[model samples]
Target: MKQNLIADYLSCILFRITGFFTCFLPFNISLFMGRRLGDLIYIFDRKHRVVACANIRKTVAEGGDWRAATRITRKAYQAFGQNLIEISFIPRINKPYLEKYINIVNKDNIEAAFKRGKGVIFLAVHAGDWELSNIICANLGFPFILFVRDQGFPRLNRLLNSYRLKQGAKIIYKQAGPRQLIETVNKNQAIGMTMDQGGRHGELVKFFGREASMSTGAVKLALKYDCSIIPTFYTRVKGPYIKVILDQVYTVSRSGEAQKDLRDNLQRLAGIYEKYIRLYPHEYLWTYKIWKYGKERELLILSDGKTGHLRQSESAAKLIIQQLAGRGIKTNLSIQEVRSRESRQGLISFKPDIIISAGSSISALNYRLARQSQAKSIVLMRPSNLSLKKFDLVIIPEHDNPPARKNVVVTSGALNLIDADYLKEKSERLKRSGFIKSALSPLCIGVLIGGNSKGFSISGRLISTVICEIKRSAEELNADILLSTSRRTSPEVEQVIKNELGGYGRCKLLVISNEHNNPDVVGAILGFSSIVISSPESISMVSEAASAGKYVMVF
Candidate 1:
């Protein structure tokens, strides 16, 4: 035990000495060294870098470039340097000097909080010069006692902690527990704590796409003392200035449930960190393994549902992803086995927008596996363990009665992938550019198709009949035949249509996902069809057909 203490003491000492050196170094040189050190860590300390990248990836998912994420990560290292500098210089912060340099927003919030007079629990995160944030609070006539974890260095810890004391911060080591913390704040003194980092027994909270361990001690402390809890942070902006903001204060209320309110209030403070982190995600410190406990974002099981029709659902998700891609949103897709590990791990890894857990076969897995996933859990069937609140969405076909949920986006029939608007717009461009001439006819016969569904294959036999009927219909109306297919139409049927109709000048055909000389055929059909007959295979194609405001026949 003594040897263990000795090692811990030495570790603390080494941290302080090095911290002091970094703090005292010239700002420009320090920044240069900081970034270089970050690069070394990025290359060698792969774990922390992975966390930083994960955090960066979430914000970057919205179109933030990879290079920008890298730049922001290195900036976190530089911010760490500033933290050391601010702490090393803490001794120089007398009340007058402190008053001149420090600024806190929402002073009224602080004053209103202080007026309660029992004490205040000030919550914050290590987002910026957090040590400096405390100095300013101390100088503002608040006897602030900071809850801090001691490093493994003795001399520097003593030196640095002594300086912290000089700035009027009453520091408390973690071992002091609830009694000491209550006492410190009992005499109308404020207790300050940084709540962003994970701890041994912390609860999990959503950060980025995963669960991260977050301490609730500060909230617990405030409730025990019936004091006020306030969250504040000081972020380093351009030049030598810092932007300090004190958020709304929460009073420890016991109107009904005492402990419940406390947890909620602490969570409120944590949200402020998440809010700010998103704004300048690159600026936030992510090098400390922020996602150590987070679950995967999403787990998308790529499977074909036996009952609901396989090719149709697969085509639907693919359609959404394709449309989103056209609009520049992207991730990736994988088979059921590929994303299954995320079920074992948690939510942070999969990072799904929506878990399209295709097929009823995987419904049981969704219950067990989704319980651990980070994303809003989605299952395709009636998820068992119905009491498990983790299941965010249950997408049962409307035909079957499933429990109501806000997370579900049910289709009228089945989902398919097709960009009707993009298709329509492209058709217009082609018409304007004169690639495919649009000519009016006496009778326009539009053919909409689906592949195999619910044991019914829309065969070439059926297509040959439909084609013959359509030709007769067009002949009776003295108009041309306009042939088209849903996204799920088999290539064989499309080939049959081309073979039967290609030589005819008056007939026009649009085929999708088939080997064809023209990819814009589907677009032209939707844009120009006077009357349309669509297949029952894909709801998405029917919907797209409807959206074009064209004449539609859903068979």
Candidate 2:
């Protein structure tokens, strides 16, 4: 009990301090202070900052740039801070202030709607200066009721409500029954409501090209009272000036079917919100998770326990995810690493829209899982035993000379996860982490040594021959070598290569084994290497080298 009282007292004291700054400071000074506070919040609020960046990445403009998202996210925090500070000034607003600072555009629309005996539903969203919108309607002598959700802080909530009441706006908490809303409409009063936030159990509707749960309360109330649902918003024009835009008013559709009518009306409202938000994107609330559930498609990736195969499969899936995002769809990716048929139990709970895999080992598993989940099956490389028709999409390399088929997508080289941007980012990370010397980055040659495999044998002579060729090439190109072997490399082969490259001036050999492996080395090699040498045992490694646009030599 003592702790609770102490916390409440501290909260009230902090609230009073904020009120002092907002209430006493000049408008411009308060706005400036609010922006600084916002920047501080952006630094300290780590969780919300992550959520905001994720939301921004999910909705960045075409040709997605990370820097653009960063700039907008920063501005979004500042806009939110400005909104709060301006909302604090609501209690002091009157007719003179509205006339001087607020410009009401399209007043004719509201007047025409008011002529109809049924009340008007001012359908709005959480955009610029939305808290002050009620003052616009109330000061103009419109009988107004603002339906608000609690801010989760009791004292802060009451303080904000006091401001609203002082402006002659009636308060109706969302938790209170709809009886109050109906009574207000029956009395021919304007009801202000915002339904832009995702509502629990709300119907899924498209917003910003992605699905989000949207509340249909405004449509329902309009249908019930035969009222006009006016699309309205107040956008901040400058530091202390605002423009209340009264956009096109809509009538609820009474298509006789409740579900259809509700969905159509809700979609209409969401469309309007999307237009305004796009125009003033930074002004919209971004901290809220807009693309909530019911908007994501699931993709399952089947791996064959090979690093090269996993990289290829992941590359293709990454491209598909990007394409989906371009079309306003969200994707959830799940990987199932299958060593044998016994791994089937791992996928029982996963329901996928598409299944993708590389290597012939998991072809049968991919087919079975796709069939069971009713997902489109996509496989990379030609299968050894399974029929091609079993899979929906077959992506094969041009070197394989696959037969002409409707489901086949033949490419020039193997798909790989490495791209220019990815390489640059990884290189920066490696430089920061001190794994690769910054001076050697431009002239590094990576040797990807694969050992014995099916239909292939690695002899001691072959090892010596490859090592001599690598040494000669390194001398000719004046490059340092970053050599690594695969799981299939024999101990004799490792010793031979280690002995040869060990005494060389600038060479690093990583012997792969059961317990000792560094996944990051692969990224570092791809990022820094100007050229790559590979053994013929693994075609995936060769393909990845060529895909990254590196000069490749197969020994």
lDDT of 1 by residue, 117-178 (tens): 87888887767777677777777775778888766555556766776787777888887657
Q: Estimate each model's TM-score.
A: 0.51, 0.58
Q: Give the worst 10-residue stretch by lDDT in candidate 2.
A: 57-66
The whole-model C-alpha lDDT of candidate 2 against the native structure comes to: 0.78
**Model 2 spans > 4 angstroms off:** 1-12, 60-62, 298-308, 311-457, 460-555
User: For every candidate structure, what is the RMSD over all alpha carbons to the true structure, in angstroms?
Assistant: 14.2, 18.3
lDDT of every predicted structure (CA atoms): 0.62, 0.78
Tens-place lDDT digits, model 2, residues 283-355? 8777776755555777989988888888889998998999989977789999987786567655655656689
Which candidate leads in TM-score?
2
Q: How many backbone clashes does candidate 1 have?
A: 29
